[model samples]
Target chain A: MLSRVLYVDIGKRSSWVVDKHDIFSKYLGGSGVASKLLLEEARPGIDPFSPEAPIIFSPGYLVGVFPCMVKAVAMFKSPLTKNLGESHAGGHFSSALRFAGYGALVVRGASEYPVAVKIKDDKVRVEMADSLWGLSPLDVERSLRESHYEGMQSVISCGKAGERLVCYSNVIVDRYHHFGRLGLGAVFGSKRLKAISILGTGEIPLESPLAVKEMYEKLNHEVVLSGKMSKYHDLGTSANMLELNELGALPTHNFKDSRFKGAEGISGEVMAESLLRRKISCPGCPIACIHLAGLRTDFAPEHEKGKKEVFSEEVLLPYNYEPMYALGSNLLLSEAKNLLRLIYHCEFLGLDAMMVGNILAWTTEAFEEGRITLDDTLIKPEWGSVEAYLQIINNIVDMKSPFYAKLAQGLLETSKRYGGREYAMIAGNNGMAGYITGYGSIVGALVGARHSHLSNSGYSIDQKTMNQPLSHEQISDFLIEQEDWLYALYSLGACYFCRGVYTKEAVCEALKTVGTEKTKEELMKMGKEIFHNLYKFKVREGFELAEQEPPKRVYQVQTPHGMLKAEEVKAIIKLYIKKREGEGLRLKPEEKALKELLR
Target chain B: MKKALRFHIDVLHPERCIGCYSCVYACSRHLFNTIDPSRVAVFVRLNGTIANPFSVIACRFCKSPECAFACPTKALQPLPEGGITLIASRCEGCKTFDCISACAIEALALDRRTKLPIICDRCGDCAKYCPHNIFRYEEMK
Candidate 1:
């Protein structure tokens, strides 16, 4: 059951499960497994929007059997960033897929009209979703959830944002969490697939059920008692606002400055006190990182009292450090409620808030510089003005004008068209995450297989150099090692939030239950092999590492450490390639450039 | 002085349940030697959005025990303290499941595989593994 990959061809409206024993066994799972599948199916130079390019969903190997290992990764050729595409969602996505008796779900081909794929255990059906196509993710979810599959069901859906093919559009898992970045939703839109509904009633067999149960109990108990996740469980990830602000690492006003003066206004402490309604946990996760923030409308006392339901709304928004920094502080919107309202719009529309934030930041700066006008955007961009931003967002989603259409394509492409390329702030064509800490963040993205900040925990590495004495070359070495190790865990279905708990030994222990036995050393080797495979796919897809250059804004912004250093980042990227070369890391034509640098 | 006590499963806080299904797995692992929540007695029902609180359902083990009395074959028996006990051999699954109706809370239902009533013996497995501690066990009341 755990060794099969489900393939769905929307053109034919047919689905089948194939045994991919070696794929899951060798790569483990998640993006690691997806990369190998993509290599086989997705031809180089194929249009990313073409039906031939597969949209893959691979749940981690440890998913459905372990706690906090809930992330299900989406792998595709990104429509937003234009290279290796990957996004992750938390909720019951992985569990649902596992329960539906598949290790991965590979979706290919385009439908003539909108449709939703339903997997009820062994049965698979593709139903027309013409009515559901243009609906909001929230509305679409409600409709499909009522459509009744067997047993417990979960829907992976995209909203109007995806239907409209917004490049940074997201695939929302359930209502709150998302495969939030790199435009996987846009790929779904291209395929004319609205959603994938799964009803799983299958059980994963454990080699030693009793020992597995004991292990699960031990990890479960430690989750609550240990202070390791106290921050996440208590105030949610938004608590990082004040902490990053104090460190002068929080992105403010499109990274003109790293710290926001009104940081306290939107801090996690304030949100938890003023607007937090509840803390929601992802499936199988004890540490509930998602915060449900309440938005109350101002009305007459009598009206407010009589119409409580209409006046008050609770939106399940993960007020994590990334979104808070990107949508809140980065754009200089200081109030928590305003940020909540804006995030609710993004989440409801299925837009990637971080990418959207970067786009807004670049747009605002361009407008301020007089490069864009009211005629261009239909509004005068202003800092911290939620009203103005709201109008722009509508325009972007509607894409009525050429300006708004370009904006929908993400910051990089929009900047090229609008004459703000210098301030675009994108790396590897993908929008940057919230933090602008230092060289670590910039370099991590440039070298990242997916060009994600967490790809190697670059900002974390930057903070490391502050305390520990490590040279630039050593820093690059460390980052490379971490990326390799993290990819191993990511493939194994371990969440970055709980990676500390699912140590190599712990993963081996968990794997042994499901009939895979490997020592810690063997696991480490597997990690590096998977890391190389992802790079191989990227290189094949025309991602040239040596041709990569930092977005001009990376140098202009004042980081926590000080002004950014282009040469230092360049040196680090060079050192990184050298380290990879030492390990026989192969690239395509990009290998020539990197080799020349080595000489 | 220490004394052995009969355990009773109670949903102490239904509103706070996050529907992680940890309790279901725990209960199943103990009773069936497998990790199948459908086999577990306790149920966590999720509807609407995740914004809404999860509802955990289980037999409250009523004081009167109507399920015990409604049984035509005397298949349902009253426990010494609370809750109803099911005698597997004497039970009949066909021609209208009367005990499932007798349980007012809709907590007692036929297991999908076995087609027998999923009666909570109140073994305390569900409460022990509830991630949020939504369930509790105490002396038979």
Candidate 2:
């Protein structure tokens, strides 16, 4: 059993189980599995905060079977993004839940009061959590651990951000890792769920012992030795700062510029030298891409009298490249201590740091341009002002003022309210993170997905176009292939990190272990079918690819690569629409052949 | 020296487990049997959010052996190695869920077709599978 399904309804305080065999088999679990479940349970046009919005958690098939790098996805109608929202968090939780004999957990309705679910093997006990309701994730974790059996239980909790229904609130697992995107935490809070504790001791059987041992040993060796994984292990995602900055793709000051002049201050090299303490791995992951940074802060206060004492203090926690880029260079905060302070505020508030940073950057630009007054704005954020940013972050979590409440709603809503649609740097209502590489596949992916970059990176298309100019038709074909491959990976419930290790042969082999005798070609075809299905779903849900384009700033800014002309970009969009229609109609070669035969 | 040793296995340190399925992989690797996690002697599951942690459940290796007392076929026997072992050959395939209900810990599972009791023999192979030292083997004096 990959996982067991646990269903609970907060409305009636009732719970039951669903086999979910069909879902698990088709999607191979994780986000793919959860997305299907969400679609079924979550009806369109329903308010995300309504009782109808079901929250589902699905663990990957490989979670409790494979070694390391297990991730579980949380899916719901996002209050913030206001679309199909799903977020993945890598930790011991998913693997443990699978081991506990559950594949998925779905919560529906709303609790009358705050409550926590504690599962000890087969027996589940719902405990009152009135005291733990407004506690931060840290405090909640500490309290729950004390009450539960020592060394045997884990707790998941939300902070003040979630309690206040901040649209970017995240569900914090352990102390650091989270389902940090698409406002899953807000969904949990809306359900009045405080935390869930699961404990189980069960075993999974395999058909071939010798084969599994061989595969595990071989895969372990490959992961540790692979160059792709080594880079992640060495500096984690922070390594990208140097690469993206050098490539002139790093978003700076709300993407007003691609390159940050103070890029050196926040490079992975600087982080490793001045802040990094150790690398933290999720579960059995060998790559261990999480770097725990130890930050020191020392700033002298002004005194009218004599001299003020200066002291340094250190704080340690995990930091990743996306958060660093979003909160650091994007906000123009060059000092490591100030950036760390902002990072800490995001964590404590249970907010998606990237979304918050992006929102702040946009607000700063708007403020500078006098598009919005200080009185009209939430906190009057200034570029590179750590003190001001920290105060704003606190205000959002605290829900102190009306403007702060609107700001807490996230960039999409904030921009809409403030008449900044043109300046709003968002894709699919989710703030864009990946640099302006190209419009080939990523644009289509952003437009196609609920909300994510993994739907289609199109980085390859950017690379190809850079080497030599390609026709729009050529770019469309390239994007279609990338999207198909990505769809296949998601369906397999495999992490992108394992893509290198689980090539065509490896995927086939893994499938065989699960009693599926699928050929690589057949699997690829199935992946393509899933991609097409998702594309159709988006269209049905009102996604228009032709309408989705990079913000105007992308074309205006002169990137290191070259200046992108608006007409060239628009032509690419037209080509993409043609290709999408061509694919949708299933008429590329066949249409040409029929016309030729008729003639 | 063939006296049956009375010992218990406690899943004490579950939080340390990353749930890599190392134990599951180890069991299947050694048993040459396909076991669903629902039937495995030991299992781990997520506690809550990704940042929260994991929970573990395994045969507590109860001293009284409620499962053995409840087994009508007398298949669940105390092993000399200090845990309960099942005699799969003697099982009646009755499809009765008595053992499942009798054991307070829910540690017993029945094989799919045979409907025979399946219990942990405490081979310590699970300890070998634990990559993070979440499980361990101990000998009684």
Scored by DockQ, the top model is: 1
Each candidate's lDDT (Cα)? Answer: 0.79, 0.68
Q: Which DockQ value does candidate 1 get?
A: 0.47
| Model 1 whole-model lDDT (C-alpha atoms) | 0.79
User: Chain A only: TM-score of every candidate?
Assistant: 0.95, 0.89
List candidate 2 segments past 4 Å from native.
A1-4, A146-154, A296-315, A441-445, A463-465, A532-537, A581-599, B1-141
- Candidate 2 lDDT at A99 equals 55
What is the C-alpha RMSD, rounded to one decimal, of candidate 2?
Answer: 7.9
Q: What lDDT score goes with residue A336 in model 2?
A: 75
The 10-residue segment with the lowest total lDDT in model 2 chain B: B1-10
Candidate 1 residue lDDT tens string, B25-105: 776677677666567778776666555567788888776788878788888888667677778888864557887787776
Q: Which candidate is the best by lDDT?
A: 1
Task: Supply the DockQ value of model 2.
Answer: 0.15
| Candidate 2 per-residue C-alpha lDDT over A1-599 given as tens digits, one digit per residue, 9 for 90 to 100 | 45358887767777777787777676667766676776777665567888778888877766544544467777777788666677777755675566567778888888889988776656666777899988878667666654422113446777778877888898887666788887888888887887876655454456665565666666665676657567777777788787888787777887777788888888888889988865555655656666778766555544323333445556566788888888998888788767888888887778888888888888788888787777756566799999888887887777677767787888767767776666677777776764666655345435445546555566546754664666767766676666666656665556666666777787677667656677878767766666554444344444555566666676666554476666776786677667667655332234454687899
True lDDT of residue A265, candidate 1:
90
